[model samples]
Target: MSREFEIAREFEVDATPEQVWDAFTTGTGGWLWPMDAPEPREGGTGPFGSTVVTWDPPHRYTNRVANVEGIAEQTLNQLDYTIEPREGGRHAWVRYVHSGIFVEDWDNQYDGADKHTDFYLHTMREYLTHFAPRPVAFTTLDGPEASKAADALSTAVRGLGLAEDVPAGTTVEVRGPDKGLFPAVVDYHNPYFLGLRSDDALIRVFGRNHWGAPVGISVHDFAPGADAKADAAAWQRWLDEVFA
Candidate 1:
């Protein structure tokens, strides 16, 4: 079965289309778009490929992205912007058209398309609105230290009996199933965790599971370098009360 869906949303940004175009075209600002490496040029290879189909200053800019994962082996994702002169300035209308069959499965394709559209629009908004240069890092846990941490966290999760307490709060705005479903007791390898962010810290609570049963506990900690002990204790108490 073949299925297709389209998502279109508009945002009233504080910046003009010219400014928006520049930010998107510039290498430094392109990260907001989640492009691997965006090199804006009429026909120069970059995230999408070589060739700028349309580059009408401020008002419109269009490019084609080839080989987008799961989509067309050579697909064209076009972005068009229109600026309408308003009371204060120009109101921008950004339209994205993705044409390619990246996936054979209709469900997967629709889901991927939905996420891509959302991310694209969100990145645009972030750039034009709350542009923050936050530090992000990635690290893998391995060896003995990693094992110890995992064990401790696992133990804590088991002790908490988390399955009983429903996780309630604002969903993690990040994309993915893990973000949408929280406080759910899942399988051992796919346990549920809660993510929290504050002005001072970002916290991740790792849940534990036995077979497919959830033990209502999680090992909580502030982002790397911050104290975990306090956060862990706090999470423990919270879980205790929640389960109680």
Candidate 2:
């Protein structure tokens, strides 16, 4: 059995539809939403085209989005916005319609649609609510021992761009996977951090701060066979330059 599903969410942005439309159609605004690299153009790039399908100025704009990767092959997505006049500005209701079919099993398609809708609504709400500048944090660590490693990592993090007054008592030790060679362990603030590793090299970086204000971390592992010492020195210099 094959199944299909449809989902829709609505929001009221403080800006006018024209303003909202610009944001929706422009690359800067696209970053605020879910699109990775949105290029608004009709029969061009991005979810929406170049010109507005229903350009009612401060009232509404409806557009069709077809040029997606995986979803484009099986689905048709249309976004419609209806803006109503309000006290100080306009109230915008965004309706996203996704109509598609499943050539295989309908149950999975239905469940997937449900999940996708939930994610879509959540993403939209997050963008609208937090339309402000946020900070991005990166962290790294180095050391001869585990404890020293943690301290070195802390130094790297502070050196990068994070506040020096990052919360204390938020560090923990983590072990690397077994692959023959020196055992590797790390001090970390959160598990979501990224880690990179190679013979004679280890680096960790915290990507971005979540809404919860927790620091993300990543570790890099590297150890050269023949040029181990030189490789390690080069890695340290790279970190220094990046954090500096």
The best candidate in terms of lDDT: 1
* Model 2, residue 229: C-alpha shift (Å): 27
Which runs of model 1 end up more than 4 angstroms from their true locations?
A: 1-7, 29-41, 69-76, 83-85, 132-244
Per-candidate RMSD, Å = 11.1, 14.0
Residue 149 in model 2: lDDT: 38
Among all windows of 10 consecutive residues in model 2, the one with the lowest summed lDDT is 132-141
Tens digits of per-residue lDDT for model 1, 114-169: 65455445545543543333332211111122223334434433433432232444
- Lowest-sum lDDT 10-residue window in model 1: 138-147
lDDT agreement with native, every candidate: 0.41, 0.40
- In candidate 1, position 224 carries an lDDT of 50
The number of clashing residue pairs in model 1 is 10
